[model samples]
Target: MNLVTQLPVSGAAPKLLDFPAPTVSGLPTPALRGKPVPPAQRVYFYSPDEWEVFITEWASGLSYRQIKQLGGSGDRGVDVAAFKTDNGLEGAWDCFQAKHYNRSLNFSDAFPEMLKILHGVVAGFYCRPDRYVFVAPQGCGSTLDRLLSRPKELQKKFLEDLNKSSAATRHYPKQTLNSIREYAQSIDFSIFQSLQLSEMIETHRKTPYFAARFGTALPERTVVKETPVTPSPDEAVYVKKLLDVYNEQDPACCSDVDSLSVHTTYGKQFQRQRESFYSAEALRLYARDSVPDGTYELLQKDVYTGVIDTAEANHPSGLDRLRAVLTQSGQLDLSAHTLISVSTLEDRQGICHQLANADKLTWVDTNE
Candidate 1:
């Protein structure tokens, strides 16, 4: 379909199976098997297990046996169904409407009236659609996000469903506890009762979309203590990149025009710029330079800390590399809170982008 959000959906549900409107002399000519609909839009193409996860959540919330009532056309436009939660209350929620696509769908077909057709969904469920959430997987368009961002009633409905789903299972991030935090930060989802969400994410990572999307998505972060200096694994990568950059920019070979020959060679530039990144004085104290506790204080205390450190603990310059990012240029706009959410927490309910920063080095945990 060209533009799904605006397609021609005037009929309660398009006769998906029937092809070119059949015309009989008297009665409707038996609808010819229409041009085949695309596989992506066809219902049977979806995974049954994943559908069940959504179905159970949706049905259990409203105490419905099944959504079969709306089988082919009843869901109104529900692509994924699930129970929703708010505070601690639960409700059957229809969500992940195809109307709200996960990332944009690339279509070879001409959908001149996709949006207009899709709006019929709004009309279908007009009298209390229960809940409406559009999944914009590749991330919502800025304009669309802005439009949806402050949708108070819509927001409330979304949150209510999420919370309800969470509460029924005791408020958890069945997908990934850490993701809850990320979502809260990225999309500003509420975390008023995040603890409950955390437990759920940990225990329920088996749910279809939950497992697929949030499954094992956390980053690996570790600290290396050599020369008694503390740096994180990512730091090593940053420092390596920085050193390469610095080596290129060092003032070694000069242009004959100015004849400042010192700014041309990598070796000479390395020698000149090396001091800033790896000072003789700092190296001399490396064995004795212990990280101040204030830094790690930020990482560990996030509501979503990890169970184990990480796989990259062996690198000596990891943490230092991250530190360099924070204290240097080309790297700007950082704060402890932002740094705290750097990595993808194994837990999934928290945002760990703090570690995602090049400046995220390991500092001694003050609270330790």
Candidate 2:
């Protein structure tokens, strides 16, 4: 059965730990195992506030200029709003109404929220949103889903329900409710829709917040294959440092990149070092998109901590010190870091250059 069909519609929602352990089918070969719970199933356990926050995070990934969460009291029916311009609701915008409940959302649970928007528009709280979306963990009930699929029927149902005397919408002023009927009648109900739980989860997967929120593994990092033949402006500091290292070994060995490129031995070393630098650069770029901020910086800190003593100790030559520090960096136990899985050997070695680029490490003793 599908994951949603396995959920309970009443009582307390099931926790992640409550699910049965994966089963291994009996076989001589490796056994087949059950799949982990999908994000769609896990979302049912989030509190109402958390649901709105998730909607906010998801909305931020869309092409909106800004996303704001207005979920608490006096929010005027908007939970999370995505704006296309700085003018906010005055400009084109989309409203995501977060509905968290023990069961799927039905017409009764959604109509009041719908009225709030209509009322808000007529009351000058804000203009009608370009689109209105219902975000619920358990999705919509069969009746609500059917109405949403048919725009004209959904609009007709809203008008019919607006005329009925019900406590659900009683707080709306009589005059306001009467005025909203005309505005509601004109609303293109096609703009009112439900966000599918699976769609939200899939789209959220592309965002940096996904792995942290859903406890999912990050997407695999692509390898950086090419390093520039000529050094770029950003590589100036480290390249100069390498030149200093080569010159320290033998004063006339190399003066600059053009001179170093033809060196019989150090030329090969320079090429390898450049490749490693670019590999680490690739990791930095990948981490910026896949994980939270400072993750790559933390990795750099760990690498520096691993090699600082080796970098400080006396060496036979600057080349020896550079080699020893790089060796120590590769041996570091960085299993605690999030990027460790995708980090390559070149990336570890290249981070030493990144440190040098920041003037954190120096090969030759300047005091000498």
Candidate 3:
């Protein structure tokens, strides 16, 4: 029941579509928000590559450093793959297929992906993903969207379309066709779904790093959805080591892991990690929103830039300097800018030195 089999006939893979180069400006507004001119309308402006990156990061709740793009020749139809761990088993994968078609996406756009996924499943190219998403800027056409909503209708339609006598399947060798027919009967149609660029933009608007990505104002805490992440085995071990080190440094400082977690530096890092976990958890609530790819890195760069500008200008401290710059530019709410974690003045100052050493003090102004 979990398997999906509405597949295309096998053939040499089609060339990748020619997507327009991505840019931050000049994004088209989507029809859905035409008159009202909704916030985040620029989402419709993203290149397919940009959309794919955003989808991977936002949906997976992975930090910018963790996501990997796999779109290209030999990608096997999957544009992005996000690695996740849950329940200690690890490897909970989600696959995103990006279709950057200029026109509204129709069955033809989806069929080859279906074929690739079905054939991949049979051949074990990858494990059955927890979610298999079809991402596009224009979104799905009426028929496909309707079918996606009603699984049985989708199953019936797919089978009928790929019937033995249908031209779509006529070219498949008999053995392949027979195999596909058998597979189609048992494939699960529910895994197939679509997301529109506009919806994704709306979702991204509420993320913590949204302002950094689009140069829009940050959402208030009330609207800032949190994303939570599962502690991988490695991360868990690292946390344990941090706590253990704290205990060794000052036995009087902590009696157990819980107590050690309260130490200044370690505690702050732990809290940040906990925030990340919650942010990941929040991602599920905004399944359609994806932080545009590289948003986090951009935020990091901006924060660093703010820090340096403040230091050079003789601002009170790195923390105060960064906050003043971001707040003045209207990109941050000084009362609650949780985009980066710095528990103390020392931590803030240390970050400035680190960024300075790396020679990466260039910050983008909200105006820019």
Candidate 4:
């Protein structure tokens, strides 16, 4: 009997099978399914040290001449220091104090750090930073936020707390604490501020390290430059090699780029090759701004490795060798490369030409 026919029929309607709904226990949540974590909440997930590192990277992208992470023991309350001049803290500088707490920072959480900075300056540890920015994932609590906006009130509260508690002065003598208080009173408290998580993430987005840090997509590749009407000095090496290949095929076919430009057979071929070369050049420039150092070079190395054996093999002429090696390059399995998604067939062919320009791959075997 067919399965459908074997089912028992109800008096008024066909009976339905009572199969339990399939249980999906291990399915990914929205975040795993490509939903991005908001930067505000995501910063809280970083460890204290990692948060310091993130701030350092973000500061490096700014106009600061130097950035240093001083987060461990004996750091004297500075987490990340951004120097505006080569002289470092001896000159103008800004301080970023990273606090990676589960909750927002309050006046109590910030007061001690402020005292530490004041003490550092008075103790000759370093000059007072031009700006003291508190960097926390949850930002400042309402109470602390209000105090920051009113610099005088914040200073008054800081002094009151300094006298009431020894949190920042336990190891120091009364004279030292007095010195810190006097130093604090002398400087402008307006320098105290807080960096919002959104502001930090926005600035960090301009840096090459953002994608790696946040698991975000890289910026789109820019358009490739149009091939020039005439060969440029930069194209001299590859252009010379292409002329040699054409000459090998037929000595009278072309002697130089000027003659080759008007050749009936090779002129169009030369233009297409230049387009491919520029395509790869565009990729190189994109990789510079989008990926880590040496990423584009690695792609070029991969192309050279895939085609070198074919290039070395015997061929009827230099033109034949060039065609064979380019074919081999096109067939390379570059899916593993970081740039594979943005790469193109033209780029692969152009990279072979780039290798030729570098003297790494010569179509015409001079010794032979």
lDDT of each: 0.31, 0.79, 0.52, 0.78
- Residues forming the 10-long window of minimal summed lDDT in candidate 1: 18-27
Candidate 1: residue 334 lDDT (0-100)? 26
Q: Candidate 4 lDDT, tens digit per residue, 263-291? A: 89888888888899999999888877666
Report the alpha-carbon TM-score of model 2 versus the true structure: 0.84
Selected candidate, larger lDDT, 1 vs 2: 2
Candidates in descending TM-score order: 4, 2, 3, 1
Which 10 consecutive positions of candidate 2 have the poorest summed lDDT?
13-22
Residue-level lDDT of model 3, residues 101-186, one tens digit each, is: 67777876777677666565544455556667888777889988888888778878777766646545654566665665567677
Error of 4 at 320 (Å): 1.9
Q: Summarize candidate 2's per-residue lDDT along 134-201 as a digit string, tens digits.
A: 98988999999999999999999999999998975688767667777867776689988998988898
lDDT of 1 by residue, 254-298 (tens): 212122213454434323322333332232122122221232333
Candidate 4 displacement at residue 339 in angstroms: 2.1
What local lDDT does model 2 show for residue 229? 90
Per-model TM-score on C-alpha atoms: 0.22, 0.84, 0.50, 0.84
Stretches of candidate 4 off by over 4 Å are 1-31
The C-alpha stretches of model 3 lying farther than 4 A from their native spots are 1-40, 60-67, 86-91, 164-172, 196-199, 206-209, 219-368
Model 2, position 241: C-alpha lDDT score = 86
